[model samples]
Structure formats: structure tokens, C-alpha cells
Target: MWCRIRRRTALPRKLKTVPTTTAPNSFPCSTAANCGKKVLDYAFQRGLMHPEDMGPMTHWYSPTPRVFLEHFKPEFMVQSSNNYDHPEQQVWDCDDEKNVEHYMELTRAHIKHYGKGELFHMIGLAEWVFGSPEENLATKIRVMKTFIRHLRREYPDAPLLIASWDFMFRWKAPEVRKLLAELDPADTVILDYTTDSGSYSNNFVNWNLPHHFPWIFGIFQAYEPQNDLFFNFDRAEEMYIPVQDDPMCRGMVIWSENSHSNPLLEYLAKRSVDEPFSLGQFCANHCGDRAAAMEGLWEIRINFSIFFRKST
Candidate 1:
């Protein structure tokens, strides 16, 4: 059934009109370890930054080990007695209405702290929270819907970014299509794709959903433990070119696991700020010549392969 979704027609080039409030570009360093500062430094040094770039503040999120969400609990609780010195000791059950309310409060606090400046809302990495062990599909979706509603009420002007994997294909349990269909397209932005899937593909965006929903293509380039298998620059170029040209695409996200990988970092930085699908320019800037750049890219691939081969 999910396979049929992959076969659906690609989204039309002339997508529905995007809201004027949409963000143009973002560099996500959430998964990268201690490298956020480094990425910012590099961007500043190269003059690749724009006043609108959210790379410096974008939060990387997953379901388990919800450190940020946990820490936010005590600080946002309305009841003074609910405060806990050790928030890590607290357990949040999504299935419970009271707990979910607390979660919403925490989300509000997060938005208040991070939501300011040009973007106006905190970028949330919220895919995993929708379906984890404690919450069933129905409960998770219900919680998310409620949370989004509250978010809209408190911060109507803020754009909501909901991060997810291949949601159309993977989230078929109780059928979230209808639930997602009901969301306001203008305020909702979906971040799709992952490094494991080799960046953006023709079927990356879920065409089955509303055409007006803003979509951001993700580019996961590096991981921890220094594996050699990374995003194929040539293939990445092929996949993202259409995305770059697509009107529906809000922007792209570049991520790494633990440490900053220069090759992938440079690739996305240039693509986001300098030019889209400009591999030649990227190579020229980094290697000083097209031939040298080609050689350098080849060397990175070879090194990646060798590193993985030995590790295995």
C-alpha cells in the first residue's frame, strides 16, 4: 500500500501559493555534536550567512531521550507545587490528558523562549513524539492535534514546523492522512526525508496531502563514529535540483550526527546561501579548480568507503 504512494505523480511545479511568512533557508545542526558553534563560526567566516538563516538556532529532535522536553517541564508548569528540581526523574505519559497538558505548557514555554526575531516561532523537531511506546497512534495524533491547536492560539503568527520521516508511507496505522489534512497549511511546515534515504528523491514529499502545506527537504550528511558512508554529492545534486527549483519547497536542512563534516557542511552551506545545485561553484570555491574539486570529492568518497570497510 505504501509502495503505491511512491508511485504517485510528483507535485506540480506551480504549487499553491505559499504564505509570505515562510522561512527561506535553514541549516540544521541539531544532530551534530558540539559543532553548532563551529558551524556558526564557519558560516560567519565565509560571509555565507543571511539575516534570515535559522541554522544557528534550529533544534534537532527525535522521540526517545527527550532531554529538551523533559527539562522544560518544571520551568513551564503553572502550578508552583508541580515544579521538580530533577526534571529527569519525571516521567511524562502521553496517553494521559493531564500529562499531555503539561507537555503543551512546556511547548508554550519553549516557544516563548526561542520564538522571536525574524522567524517568530521556535522550530520544533517533533516526529518521534507523535508515536512512541507510551502512546498509541490515536492518542499520539490526538495529542499532536491538540498541541498544535494550543500553539496556534498562543502564537498565531509563528510558523509551526513539524518534523517527520516518510509520514505518508510510514504513518498508515490508524490513518493520520485525515488528521493531517485538517491542519492549516499556512502555518504548518513539514520537514521530510533523512540521510538514510539518500536525501531528497522524487517521492520525498507526500503528494497525497494538501498542496499548500510548506515542505522542507532534509539532507542528512554525516553521523557519529565517523562512518565512511555519507551523502553522495553527485546523487545529492540530482535529487535536490528539482527541489531547489520547486515552488512548494520552503528550503532544505543540512544535518550531521556528532561532529562537523567539512565536505557535507560546505556542500549545504553553498547550496543554501551561495547557489542551488551549484556543484561546480562549490568545488571551485573549496578546491580552487574544477579538476582539483573533482579529485577532492573522489578522495572523500574513497576515504569514506575505506573507513566503513575496515570498521565492518
Candidate 2:
């Protein structure tokens, strides 16, 4: 049997047929397991890390994610574990008594493992539930409430991040407002996951902004199969400066499905926090006489996404 993991999905075509000793769903085969441990050890020993080193994948609530809390113990981690993302039969049907109980057990275990304080920021795939049968919504909400209860019990300072996908897909203000009613304004946070992708171009999630709702701005330059650079420098500049002055905007996150696929975008995201990022200044310093050509190059990449969208 074989198992393959890639950006939010599966392997690239060329690598799809690759073999694995372990059977299906073995998240960390020997190599992967060791690499994870090694990376964590290195971070612990050197007192160093990457911004992307914060957490595991979006659905990474499995024991696989526990390793990071157990070992990597980074400064921050995003807890994206939930019933919908669980690896079991009751995943999509999380209202089952056993499933509900087990989900809470896992939540408590992780929170205890991390040992109090705000070492983790939580995330949710709200669409994970809403996209499914509406009948099961109550149980899904129960799972969320229980998980948040456990998290807040242990890490009172941390916030539960309601990811943007909830809005990017079928969920909208009414559904979100209903859920928010259960949470404290201070303890609640929003992850606006894809501010730059056309996939979310018309998503009502970002529309009808509730000035009272605090949120983290995000940049999803490119997801898995289309890892090419199609980032928007101009849009980034336009959005970055103004949000800096907004009190409700809590922070920024690199919400890409794959990491390091767009280093310049990542760097600009970080650099702009101190001051507005200037493409001309960056190109003049890094690309020299090729500044104009660099601008033209970005313009080309901006439009490059249309090709990937078509091919896929």
C-alpha cells in the first residue's frame, strides 16, 4: 500500500505512482517521522525557527500533530483539529455519542500536552460542516464548543480562529454570526484565508465587514498543484498599509496551501509590517537595471494563474 500527501490534496502527477512501504494513511512513514523529529530537535537545540514552523496542516489533529507539541514546541502553533478533519468513520458524522466524547478527549489531551498558556491559536474549517448535511450542524457546533472549552480552560489567552474558507465556500454572515454568539469578542478571531486568490475573489466572507469583528488578514498566493508564483504585489501594498491602522485587524498570516512557494510575497508580507513594501525599491536593490523588466515579470505572473485554472 502507499500514502501520498501534498498541498491540501494529493501528489503531483509525475510523483503519484511512487511506492511506499507503509500502507494507506500512514501519515509519517519512517523517513517522514524521522525528519519531523530531527527538525524539532534542531529547533529546540538551536533556539531557531521559521514563521511557517508554527503548526501542522489544516486537518492535522491526528496524533501526527501531537508530535509538534510534544517535541517541536515552537513559540506558536495553529490547532486545526476537528471532527470533520478527524481520521475516522464518524468524521463527517461527529454527533455520534462516542465520537463526541472522543473528540473532546483528544482536545483535552493536546491542550494538556502543550501545558497551559497561549502556545496555540486554534483554526476551524467551518465549511467542513456547513458543506455537509445541515442536520448534523448541532453536533458539529457541539464539537467546536467542547474543543474551545478545553482549549480556553488550558490556554486562556489563546483565540479560536474561524478560518476564511467558512465564508469562501457556502457559509456566510448569518451562519457565522450564529456561531459567534457563542464566543467572546476578545477570545474570538478570524482567519481571512485567501485575500489574493480569484478563487475567493467574490467570496461573501470578506464582504460586509463587521467592524467589531477582529481578524487576521491572509495571503494565499498559490495552492498545491499550481505552486507557480501568481502573487499580487500591488494589491498587497494597497491592503497592507491601511490595515496597519485598523484596530480590529489583529495580525497577518501566510495562508498558502504550500509554504515557501512565493518567498518574495512572504518577505514582503513580513517587511511591510514595519513599513509599506515598495516593489520599485525592492527591484532596484535586488534586480538593478532589470526593475522595469521585473515589474513586467510580476504582471505576467499575476496573469499566469488563469492558465493553471484552465489546465486544472
Candidate 3:
């Protein structure tokens, strides 16, 4: 999926939404529009997409929210916590029965409106609990698990793609592990979205260091403010090669705060999975006469990241 943040589609028109399902009430979709799929069968499972669909396509697009919310919009902070934020004190208190039902309503609405998209093939809550200072770990986990169970009961169409960021900074590794272990493995697919740059930790200790679940490989390249351009071509070998060999690796899903700025590198992230990456051949394939210069430019010994700062 060529994910970009805009009202319109991407540049040069690489992606086109091709309707997959012929069934009634199904949404038009592009199963791997630019990348590569389960075609149309929504129940077939395999598809590619980013978590942004939940933002533009899922959460906001639906008319259902307006019905209940009715113009009184509670602000959504970066993290959905019980209590803790600025400019707004709207706590996503799962312990509250009314809050839980309201959450379930919106969640169901999201799936109903965007489920057939295939990229919406999997469901995920991007910003989960943020573990405030007065958090009760056990109670929070219990409430979340129960909520998930309710979702499982209602929508069994696709696997729940859980984000590692959900409990990463807020909890210890062992506690996170326990929460993961208790989840229904058959029903959940973990997206360790920041697999490439473990910069979220003190020193490259990713939230899931020793993963043993149905996990997908990911390279979350950009954040909210965006970053400067610094694409590492060597990742075709260094990053994806090992993933190709790992048994636990289900598939790949690339994440970014923007739609996508670098097509060549983005393609390589997906392309390298099926075959080895050759800078010369890859450059030759795309850059034509400038292949050598392009290859040389990317040969810098830096870790994988392409930061492009948004101007103030």
C-alpha cells in the first residue's frame, strides 16, 4: 500500500484503488497497489497497509461518529491514557462501563465502514494506554484483554494487529511479555513497527527483543514531525535478509508519518523480501545513467533512517 497523508493520492500516480470484492456493501480496495496479495477474498487474510487508514479512512470518514458524538468532540491526545495530558483532560478510562461501550461502538463502526478495504484487513488501536503515574497495571491489562475478547467475539474476520508502542515505554519488558502471552495468538498479529530503529529504547532494546508470536516485520521510518532524508540501501541485506530467514516472521509492513517520500527505497523494502538487494542492479533498474552516483550516495555507513524535518 502506498500510504501518504493528503486528501488526494500520491505523485506520478503509482497507486490506483482497484475494487477487489464483487459482494454487496464491500469497499473498493487496492491489495498492494504498488507493492504486490490475497486478491479479493477478505477472509483470505494476507494484505499490506499502514495504521494511518485508521485515522483518515476508518475513524474520521464514518458518519457513525457524528451520530453519537454530535459535535462535542473530546480532544485526542498523542497517547490515550486514563488521566494525563494537556489542553484536554479526556481520559480513555476502560474501567468505566460507559466508556467501554462507547469505545466498542466506535471500534465496530471503524470495521464496518472500512473492513472490506483489505488494507483495513487487520484492526489495530494505534494509541492504547499510556500508563499514567497512578496506573494499576493488573486492572488495566484485564480491562484491555476483556475489551479485546469482546472484539474477538464480534469481529472475527481479521487478526488484531497489536502495536508494540502500546506498552513499550509505559511498562517493563516482562510485563509487556505477559500481556502478549495471554492474548489469543490465533487471533492476534503483532506489528513490532519499529523493528529497524530501536531508538525508542535506552540502547537498541526493542520492546519485543525475543518475540515468539505471529509477528510481522516493520520499518517505521517517520514520526509526527517527520525527519530528513537519509535512506540506507544496505538494509536490503542487513534488515530484510534475516527476516526472510526467520520462522516467526509472517510478512512485512512499512510505516511512516507521511504517505511515502522515497519510492525506490520503499519498493526495495518489499522487493528485498523475495530476492536479495543489489545496489548496482537496483540503481541500474531505476536511475538509468545515474546508477553509479546513486549507489555511491547511498553507500554511506549509517543505520536505517530517512528523517525529513517539517519546516517551522
Candidate 4:
């Protein structure tokens, strides 16, 4: 029974190859999964939040340092304030070279975790400079150049899209536009504003600064895509409803923290055909003070079956 001696078959080793680089798709929004939920859905339907928004990217919804980069997801996200950190509350000055370098390292970590090419439309401070228009213009230009210089060195391939000043355009449009034009051709940046006159007041969304929309409109009309375009949804209820009227409504910048922060959401939930919006204690502007408390006291109560592993 000397069965024909079976020759030991040898398994071949897998070959290792270097990874190839490919450019990112410009229009990454085709399927519903990729597009996720639209802002109108969030407003009108009171829909459930997507996993990515609530997962590791939750930091994008918070107000803190290095958090500015968290909104870099390909889809739309809104934030309350553009304030990076309370630099005023710092024990040691952060503007110093050493401190800036340290923070820059932290900034790199944020970009690594969050997509680097995402656009951020923020409110509160318009005109990248401080002080009067005349003095601030020059200083803002210099600061922008320095900031861009740093970004170029670290993230040469990534783009930094910014809306310089949505509210202060009346005072700082011309110079701001010029500076934006001078930015690297590949850099993504755009200034934005609320087009509706009613945005100035209302319980849900408020745009306190008036008389600046004209200047902002002019810039938007003339803007070329050498940079990015963003829409700040600080008061989304008022902004999104009116934005459908404008032909140039391209990108959305939303910053609603709590359901209460947006009165329109409440209205839509009560009347709309979609999901009901929760009357939660979510203050979009200052959730940092009470985020932990809210999480503990109130249950978001979403399913975690897929995300969890069964214990043996």
C-alpha cells in the first residue's frame, strides 16, 4: 500500500507591493450613504444622526482647541463660535513662538484624525483681524499670510477653506477679498453671509449684524472657485429656509447644538411629516459647560447593537 508518495505541496509567499497614491474624488456626494442626511432633514424631519457624526467626530461639535479641524468631514457640519480657545484665560501667552509650535503639533494630530480638506464656516468674529477696519485689515492680511505659510509647510496637499467674515463684511470686504485672491491657487477659502433680511431676529436663528449682506453678496457673485465656498448655519432655521431662493447656495455650515437652540426645528417637528424633533436642552453656543451633564441626565438612547460585541 505504498500510496504514490504524495509530494509535499509548497504554498507560495504573497508579494508585498508599495501603495499607490490617487487623487480624491471632487464630487464625493453621489449615494445617500455618502451624502448622509441633508440639513433640511435635520431641520424638518428631526432624523437620527449618522454614526460618523456621533462617533470619533463628536469633537467637531465641541468648542475647544484643535477642535476647529474636527469639522473637516466631507459632509456638512455646523458650529456655534469660531473661537479656537479662550486664549485670554491661558496662564501663559499662546501667541508666543514656543506655544504656537506646541499647539501646531496638536493641530497636526487633529488634521490626521479629521480629514484635512474639509471646509469650516464659523461665526462670531468676521474679518480675520482685530480692531478697526483700517488697522485690522493690514494686521489680518499679515496674520493670514503667516497662518497660510504654516499650513502650507505642514499640509501642502490639504486645503484650508475659510469664510473670513460673514457678519462684518460691511467694514471689511474689499481688502478681505484681495487677500483671499492672493491665497495659493489650490487653497480653499470663501467668505459667506445670510441672505435673508429676517435673519437679524427670531428666537431660533439670529443674525444680529445687518447692513453687511450687500457687501457679502457682491463677493459671492464675483467669487471664483480658486477657494472654497461655505454657508454658516448658526441660525439654520432662518438661513436654510431662505437659501433655496438663491441660485448660489452651494455648501452648508451648520452649528446647532441643542434642539432648543433652533426654534425652527421645534416648529418643523410639530408640523412636518418626518420624525419628531426632541425638545432637548442643547445650547449650540455653550454646550461645553453642560455636555457631560446632559449626556448623563438625558439618554440619546440610540441602538448600539452593531457597534458592540457580545460577551461570552
Best by lDDT: 2
Q: How would you encode candidate 2's per-residue C-alpha lDDT over 54-166 as one tens digit per residue?
A: 12233433333332233423232212334443332113233344433433443343333222333334444343543344533444456667666665665677655655664
How does residue 280 of candidate 2 score in lDDT? 63
What TM-score fits each model? 0.53, 0.61, 0.58, 0.36
- Tens digit per residue, CA lDDT, model 1, 1-312: 001110111212222121222124743323332253355456557755312112112112212123344333423211122323233423354445665454454333322322122232222222223334334355545646755666666657666655554353345423445545666778766665453343233245434322445777666554553333334566666566557556777877765654656767676777777455444555566666465757566667756765776687
Choose 1 or 2, whichever is better by TM-score: 2
Question: Candidate 4 — which residues are off by over 4 angstroms?
Answer: 1-87, 90-99, 112-132, 164-171, 191-249, 261-312
Ten-residue region with minimum lDDT total, candidate 1? 1-10
Off by over 4 Å in 3: 1-89, 112-140, 156-158, 167-172, 200-211, 223-229, 263-273, 299-312
lDDT of 1 at 310: 62
| Clash totals in order | 1, 0, 8, 6
Candidate 3, position 73, lDDT: 40
Instruction: Residues 154-259, candidate 4: write the lDDT tens digits.
Output: 5576544444333344333345445545665444434343332222422112322122121122112122211111112232333445443443333333222232
**Per-residue lDDT value at 215 in model 2:** 76
| True lDDT of residue 44, candidate 2 | 45
RMSD after Cα superposition, model 3: 10.1
- Estimate the TM-score for candidate 4: 0.36
TM-score ranking, high to low:
2, 3, 1, 4
Residue 271 of model 2: what lDDT?
Answer: 58
What tens digits encode model 3's per-residue C-alpha lDDT throughout 246-299? 666677666665645464355546564575555577678878999888766655
Flag clash pairs in model 1.
33-258
